[model samples]
Target: MGAVAKKELKQYFHSPVAYVCIGVLMALFGFFYTQVLISGSSSNISYVYSNMFVWCMLVIPILTMRTLSEERRNKTDQALLTAPVSTMGIAGGKFVGAFSIYGLAMTMSLIPAVVLSFVGKPNWGMIFGEYLGALFFGMAMTAIGIFVSSLTENPVIAAIGSLGIAIFLMVIDSVSSAVNNPVLSKVVSWISFSTRYQQFTSGTFDISSVVFFLSVTVAMLFLTSRRLESRRWN
Candidate 1:
């Protein structure tokens, strides 16, 4: 697993994909930071973090789209399946590789928070919570992308499929608001990613939300492994 992860991480750095994703994230973060600073909203980092969901939705697909798809496309998946590693190991390694890039990009984008600390008393608790939330959210999204990628040999198809799912998840919260049925609304809200994420933005460290994100990530990766295992047999 470690070897696979290292190889995937190396591949990420060897290509422009990782750099481009990081650059896009950094550019979005810079724009949000400037807007927040200019608007005198340094005290609240939630806006900046919340806005990042949109950017994550865009970049995560690009990052994970090629994970399994490229292997299949290049006829390398056979080697991976016949190797000593388990399917879960392969999926987990790819997840970690993609997530490491996501985490590093996010960490770099937190420079604005450090700068704000010098100027005024920023809510460190809220900032920490938001960052944690973003990390979990990104992990879940990346897992979903990985699962989507496993379903197709074409990276473009994988990206589009993942993007559609991401958009659906993002739109769930909005859709829930319009529903008048109480039970249905509650169910929809409960399933919405933003609903759980909002807790962290509000500086609330809800253990359940953390578990929910991790659970989704694990479930997706499990499904991805299953998909690969089936392909291995077929």
Candidate 2:
């Protein structure tokens, strides 16, 4: 699995996709960081990572859009399919590759936080919780992207399809809150990215949310593996 993951990681770095994804994420973070934070006013990140919801909505697709699709499109999947590896191995490799890219982007974004800590007493607790939430969010998004990638041979289609679903989840907060129906709103709110993750940024680490994210990530990966198996029959 390590060897397979390494190969997948290498492919990501070899192509321009990884670089483009990280660059776009960082650039957007910088742009949004300024808009969300005004100088000399609290100097906090209440809205910065909060606004990351939008970035995740669109970027997860870009990062995962090519995972399996490129292989199918190039017919390189034949080698993988015929290899002695299991379906879980293939899905795991792709998930690790996507997760690594997301991790790299998150690490790069930390430069600003490191810089800010020296000048003021930054909320380390909140930062830690925020990254935790981000990790879960990114993992779940990657899982979704991996599944999308398995569905099509076109990277463009994979990205767009994943993006559509991600965007829907991103705004579930507003939708659920506005509907004013207790039962339906509660269900939607529970599924909302902001609602599920709000406790993290609010300086409280909730185990249930963490577990939920992991469950979703695992479920998507499991589904992706099943899909790959089904494709062999088709």
Candidate 3:
């Protein structure tokens, strides 16, 4: 798993994907942070984090688009599958590699908050919770992208598919409202990413939200592994 992850990371950096994704994320973060500072709206860094929700939907897909898709396209997936590693290991390693790139961008985004501290004190606990929420959100999105990548050898298609899924999750609550069945609507609402993310911006560590994000991440990764496992038999 570690070897796979290391290889994925190396691939990410060796190409322009890692640099482009990280640059875009940090640039967006800087833009939002600057707006917050100028507006004097809220001292809490959660403001920037909250505003970044939609931007992440764009960035994460690009980050994970090539994880598995590129391997299949280059006919390297067969070699990896026949290796001594389990499908789960490959999926997990891919997830880690993609998420690590995202994590680095998120970490660098903290520099703005650090600079803000010189001017005024921000709520550190709230910032922490927001960061945690963003990380979990990124994890789930990365897993979804990986699963999408597994379905197609084309990275462009994988990216579009992942972005579509992210957009769907964002508007799922609105879609649910159009449905008449109470139980079904309630069930659909349970997977609303924006709702779960909003809970963390309030500075309260909600266990349920954490669980929801992790469950999504795990389920997507499991599905990705299963997809690979099926390919192995074929």
Task: Decide which is better by TM-score, 2 or 3.
Answer: 3
- Worst-scoring 10-residue span by lDDT in model 2: 34-43
Error of 2 at 217 (Å): 0.6
Model 1, span 48-125: residue lDDT tens: 989998788789999999999999999999999999999999999999999999999989977978887787677888
Clashes of each: 0, 0, 0
Pairs of colliding residues, candidate 3: none
- Between which residue pairs do clashes occur in model 1? none
- Structure candidate 2, residue pairs in collision: none
Question: lDDT for model 3, on a 0 to 1 scale?
Answer: 0.90
Candidate 3 lDDT, 138-178, residue by residue in tens: 99999999999999999999999999999998889888888
Residue-level lDDT of model 2, residues 1-234, one tens digit each, is 566689889998899989998998888778765563446433466566787767865888998888899989999988887778788888998899889989889878777677666556567677778878888888888998999899999999999999889888878778777777899988886777778878787878889888888988899999988988887667
The 10-residue segment of model 3 with minimum total lDDT is 38-47
TM-score of each: 0.97, 0.93, 0.95
Residue 226 in model 2: lDDT: 93
- Model number with the top TM-score: 1
